[model samples]
Target: MKYIVKLNFEVDGSVDKPDVIGAIFGQTENLFGQEFDLRELQDKGRLGRIIVDIKNKGGKIEGYIEIPSNLDRVETVLIASMVESVEKVGPYNAKFELKEIEDVRAEKLKKIIDRAKEILTTWTKEKNLDIKEVINEISGAVKTGEIIEFGPERLPAGPDVYSDPNLIIVEGRADIINLLRYGYKNTVAVEGASGKIPHSVVELSKSKKTVIAFLDGDHGGDMILKDLINANVKIDFVARAPVGREVEELTGKEIAKSLSNMVPFSQYLKKQQESTISVQPRVESVITEAKEQQAVQVIEQPRKEIEIKIPSTVMEEIKKLPGTLEGIIFDETWNPVERVQVRDIISKLETITNGNASFIIFDGVITQRLLELAASKNVKLVVGVRIGGINKKPENVKILTLADVIGP
Candidate 1:
């Protein structure tokens, strides 16, 4: 049926369902014409049987009426109006009110759409490999280097950890294995059954040329860094996976990028201080300009560093850019819009057509010529490893050195 015309009815005296049904047919007959008659429509098979549900209430009969129809909406509603005009049923006064003409096909269509969505969801879940399966497949495909038990604690480590001049310290055994897959053999895990830093790892840190504490990107990583320092591990640099990510779960490209972005240990500590409201002046005195220049040799830290207002994301990018010698352009939202070599910054700035470049972060010296070009392009800030001897500084363009971004 295309439509169901429904309504409620009341009779002054007792009546049965058939009596009310008869009254509707008798009253609405020939109201408009034979074509608009309910009985005629039912005879022609365009209308279905009329259903009446009645009950006794307060010594009077009150019930509902439903008439199924395959006629068009205009014809169905006209039939409903004719039924509502009925005034008597078998010598008893009656009243009928038009309720609604419900379109049956629309409701059925809605249910069909809902069922289709459910089927599609179940089919997708059954046909596709889940995230864990995909990760396992990728992990199994990698040909990783062999791991070895190193030192007295029998820590998980790569073969070259003892002989390599540089060392990388990670959190767990899986982290060590993941690094080994990326050709990084100078790796060791600090985690053991005792959850303490092994004496051999501490001694190796002191002897290695550069010991980088490569850790996860969560609060646990922060705690481990503190424990390493408390245990007197001589760390030279620090690298972390992207926020909320673990070292073991990172892909090869992610591992390379995180290693390339490693920052000096002193600079890392200074950044941690900046996250809080009050920064201790002693932190500035310890990480001196001379020490910071050991890796990137352009910046000069003043006796007292000036604090400037800049986004935290930009500060984070600066900390990662010391030894990489690369440049990154950021849009107003602090997103890295473009990245290029430090030497190609001038050419890149000249070709910028979007005018959305708000900050330039590079690992080189900022000269006077760069400042003029930055001002012409309407760039707001320029940050670099150092500031060279500049004859003039543009008022519109603000320049910051690595020391200024971190601390003294």
Candidate 2:
């Protein structure tokens, strides 16, 4: 069908779905003549079966209706208007309101376009050449000249490992590949055959201007870095993926952020020391004591930063507002009421009826003027990216920063 007319209806008294359907056909009949009659159109195969869904609430019947049509927009609108003119269902008074006229073909076209893109992506992943081969072909370099295998251990690495002044060490081959895709060629994985630090890696680290240990955000990564330290590898800086995340799965933006936020080895060690929980010595055995300490540290340190519990609906709005410089107003039930640019938040607040807006979330700073206006509107909470200078605090309104809601 080319179009589907959708409507909502209410009956003063309880009624069945069949009653509503009968009323739509009986009342709208003869008004538009025989050619436009629903039954006549159905007989000619130009109209599909009328569908009704209804529910009884407190002796009142309310529901939705859908009527498929192959007619043009004007005819489809007329059909909707005829249905909306329905005033009675059985012996009770009723009201029907037009909701929308959905174009079936347009929706199908959108789905087809999405599916085509997905198929193209899957095919490209399956048929594309290896990363090294593709890079070699593009550079017009010999196969052996761009060799990514490094050291006697034959570890997976990028081609510029020897030429680049800086080096980045990761957990496995996949991490190196991920970095290479983002144009970082001085990456090498420390995954040796026996899971030990390779001697070539130590020597290469000593030769580089700066050596950075970029590992995953897990216990295994910590153990690997400890092993590297025990092997006497020269690591000048330390970078880690987000908590519970692996370097191999990070995007280019994430990789760049991790590298840019890297801390000096000494500072990283200090932070780790501060976060570690103290454990009393155990007399059973040294190994037993060490295992207890490791487990205690992991349990004591929470992966996420301190955050407040927010309704999922509110959280979703907060996630989208960042970087958009937009502000959203929510009702007391946490449903979004209005969305406007940050600069227009004051004007939007003025337009809202008092007590209707309960929450305000925005990308910009929370200033005193906003708090005063929000307080007058009886807003319960105001959350912003940051808080600005404020002389007076409102009693009814609770303020919070964006960081107070999201966790790292």
Candidate 3:
């Protein structure tokens, strides 16, 4: 069912202020335990009219929004509550009324998504050419004959091997095999491009700063290539097998060479400056260059002034530590900045390994973003001799908070 709710207000006194109207709505949202998204209500709140239709009772609310035409009863209550709360805000009396529309054809949510994915898959299959090429690549990558599984907790191993992003996509165990072959071991694969991209993939992708699409070359590969592009993923790059090759089909050395060549989204864009490709790297050259450049530039040391007033005993303890966390990343002049821009460096993890990364033993507070970045990069652990809670361990990601990565 579709519904339109109209809010008409009359102030009790001679006062006309647009900000007041907005204030009323804002207060109403807070008072009623409602979330207000202005874009959702923009027409009514700003242009002052709205038609809302919802499959479920509640989403969130903004100060403004464009609502669909129909809604379930629960949603109607939420909308109604908005008007009641606003009425109190203006010191003005407000009235809200709803209108409904019945039975119209809208694509099933799943159907729209599937179609979008299908259309976008065109880009992923071909690094720069035909869809047939992508399908062939996928079928070839799948030939290695190993099974890979993905579920809530016991996820697949190795690199993420899907063309589409906005989801943690993967291909087959063999694809995983090739990635592992290159020491590119922290990835997840869906086994084949046949299944729906899972919810877990969606969750993981949404939680990241960047997504690197790694797929083998083939026709099925092309299909998914298009699917990901069509799905409107904010993908960073598409890394693919080289011409006339599949990851599993390649020798370990060849795979290693290919892995070394993966590219970034920015690089991919440079390659397909004109094509409709979803843009992963060409793999062999791109991945290798990408990783190597990353490793060398991981921590930039420069000097910055920070007041370090420590108890004499604690100050002496620092001198006894090995590979102490006191290294610095620079601020352009090659001088040390007080703290490692840990968040800045950590955020670069397009994809991270599970448990093998160098640890950071620092002194002082670890910001939340830095902790998140560390966890994303799978940097082993964060050990601080000084007191800090900046990086709280989130449930989806993990980090060991220690006085020392080993122990005090």
Best by TM-score: 1
lDDT agreement with native, every candidate: 0.76, 0.77, 0.44
Worst 10 residues of 2 by lDDT: 277-286
Residues 189-276, candidate 2: write the lDDT tens digits.
Answer: 8862223698899899888469999977654456667677767889899999887566755666788899999999988777765766
Poorly placed runs, candidate 2 (over 4 Å): 116-408
TM-score: model 2 vs. ground truth: 0.39
Backbone clash count for every predicted candidate, in the order shown: 0, 0, 85
TM-score rank order: 1, 2, 3
Please identify which of the two predictions, 2 or 3, would achieve the higher TM-score against the true structure. Answer: 2
Which tens-of-lDDT digit does each residue in 1-408 have in candidate 3? 344444434344334345345654566544534234443445444223443322211332223223343445565557555554554424544333333322223346657888889877976664565454345445533432332345564445543433333332445444454444334544666434332555555555555535666665543455455445544545665767666344444544565555457677566667665564434533223435435543543432122122222345433444443222232222223232333422223433333344434344443234455567665654443444322222134333323323334353
Model 2 has an lDDT value of: 0.77
Q: After superposition, how far is residue 293 of candidate 2 from its true place, in Å?
A: 19
For TM-score, candidate 1 versus 3, the one ahead is: 1
Order of quality (lDDT) = 2, 1, 3
